[model samples]
Target: MPLVRIDVIEHRRTSEQLRELADAVQDVMLETFAAPARDRYQIITEHRPGRIIAEDTGLGYTRSEDVVVVQILQQGRDEAQKRAVYRALAERLRERTGLDPQDLIVAVSANTRADWSFGEGQAQFLEGRL
Candidate 1:
């Protein structure tokens, strides 16, 4: 199992639109990754279109345009899987939100269970350590 964290940054035009877009993105991700619904985490941040500055730091950000960055964290250490997941979410988000696909940036990072902490002074996840 893996934990996913999604961060979406875009123009703060309307709350309804932002919420709908975020929900749709999460839906696509959960299905694509075969992840449990509860394991999926999405964080949406709204910014003014004029205030956003997209930079190309391998994540392919275009300056002077609003953007949405989707970060997917998984257990399996597969680069292709991450790309596929990001593309899937970005595609679905664009389709549902009517947002320009060019403005959306999808990035994925995978981590092992040992790397995660459940908080509250809990122990880290370890194989066969339960």
Candidate 2:
């Protein structure tokens, strides 16, 4: 399972727009990472103005208030798959939500089975329930 957190500036997008953005990311996860159909976990947070700040890091590209920062926590994904997810997220978010590709920032983190407990304080992956 990949747990995703999407952060965006408050008052910039409507609730429907947020769902569309999340759906776009989910589509990318399913297509590129091959995650399970029901294994979707996403958290979308809207921060107050000036609460989120992102610099270009000298990439010569400027970001606007429409920035979207996505953090993905997953396991067993190779570099090629990660790259594909990034590209797909950018394209899909742009097409679905009108978000600028340059304003989309994605970061994927690696985790193991021991790191997750679906419920009941049980380690499902370790117990072979996953």
Measured by TM-score, the strongest candidate is 2
Looking at model 1, residue 59 earns an lDDT score of 70
The digit string of per-residue lDDT tens for model 2 on 1-130 reads 8999999999998888888899999999999999999889999999998998999989977899999999999999999999999999999998989888889999999999899999999999999998
> Whole-model Cα lDDT per candidate?
0.62, 0.93
lDDT of 2: 0.93
TM-score of each: 0.70, 0.98
Candidate 1, 1-130: lDDT as tens digits: 4444433445444688777776777676667666665764666655545555566778754533446666666676466666676677667876887667677766566666677666665554654443
After superposing candidate 1 on the true structure, give the runs of residues whose Cα lies further than 4 Å from its correct spot.
1-11, 48-51, 56-64, 127-130
